[model samples]
Target: MTAAKVLVAYGTKNGSTAGIARTIADALGEQGLRAEARPAAEVLDPSPYDAVVLGGALYAGRWHRDAVRFSRRHRRALSGRPVWLFSSGPLDASANKRDIRPVPGATRASMRLNAREHITFGGCLQEGAKGAVARMIVKRGGGGDYRDAGQIRAWALGIARELTDVTGGP
Candidate 1:
C-alpha cells in the first residue's frame, strides 16, 4: 500500500510561516510519511491528501485571509480528515505577548472545523523583508529571529504519533 500523504498548507507574508511549514513537512517525512508544503493559494483542493496541516501568518492578531479561506472552503474535507492548525507571528518568547493574542473572529472557522490543535509560534523579523510600516515597527521593537526549530519538530513528531495511533503507522 502507498504511504499516507500529508499536505502542509500555509499563508505567509515575509516567508517565516512558509519556512515553518517546510520544516513540519520535513519532520513528518522523517517519521515515515509523505508530506509536501504548499502555499495556501496554490492548493486547489485538499481532498487528495490523507491529512492536512494548515497554518497562517498572524498580523494584527488575525490569521491571513488566504489561510482563513482555505480552511473555510475545505472545511468538510478537513473535518472528515485529520487537520492541525498553527499561527506564526509572536515575535517574542513571552507567551503572554499582547500582539500574539488569539484573534477570536479569525479563529471561528478553524474552531468550527474542530482542528486537532492550534498552536501559535514565534515569527521572524528581517530587514527589507517587509513593507515600510512593518519595517518601522520592527525597527522600534528590535527585530530578531525568534522561531524555535526544536519546538516545531517536537510538535510535528506528536502529530506523527497521533496519526500512527489512528492509522497504525506513520
Candidate 2:
C-alpha cells in the first residue's frame, strides 16, 4: 500500500523553525512515510496531503502571521483531516512549558481547525540573526540555543507513529 502523504509546513524568521520542520519530515520518512517540509507561505493548498503538521517560530508570544493565516485559509479542509500545530520559542525549557497557552490571535484563529495536538519547543537564538526588537530582547535577557534535539526527535517519532497508525501504514 502507498504511504500517506504528510505535509510539514512551517514559518521561520531565523531558520530554527525550518530546521524543526525538516527534522520532523526526516523522522517521518524513516518510518516509511511520505513527508514533505515547506514554508507555510509557499503552500497554496492543503488539499494534497492526508495529514498536516503546522509549525512556526514564536516571537513575543505570537506565531508567525503567515502560518496562522495559512491555517485559517484552509480551516475547513484542515478540520476534516488530522492536523498538528507546534511553535518554537522560549529558549529556556521552563519558559517553554510556561508559554504553553496559545497566543491570543492563534487561539482565536485555530479554533476552527480543531487541531489534534499543540506543542511548544525550545528555540535557538543565533547572534546577528534577530530583528531589531528581538535583538534588544536577546541582549537584555541573554540568550542561548536551547533546542533539545533528543526531545525534538522524540516528538517527531511520536507524530510519525500516530500518523502511521491512522493511515494503516505497516
Each prediction's whole-model lDDT (CA): 0.83, 0.81
Best by lDDT: 1
Question: What TM value does model 2 have?
Answer: 0.90
lDDT of 2 at 94: 64
Residue 129's lDDT in candidate 1: 64
- Ten contiguous residues minimizing lDDT sum, candidate 2: 94-103
Candidate 1 regions exceeding 4 Å error are 95-101
- Best TM-score goes to which candidate? 1
Candidate 1 structure quality by residue, lDDT tens digits, 1-170: 46679999999999999999999999999999999999999998889999999888887777988889888788887768888888887777753333344566346856866787777778887787677867987779766677889888988999999987778776
Q: How would you encode candidate 2's per-residue C-alpha lDDT over 55-131 as one tens digit per residue? A: 88888878888788888888877768888888887777763355477676557655767787777888877677769
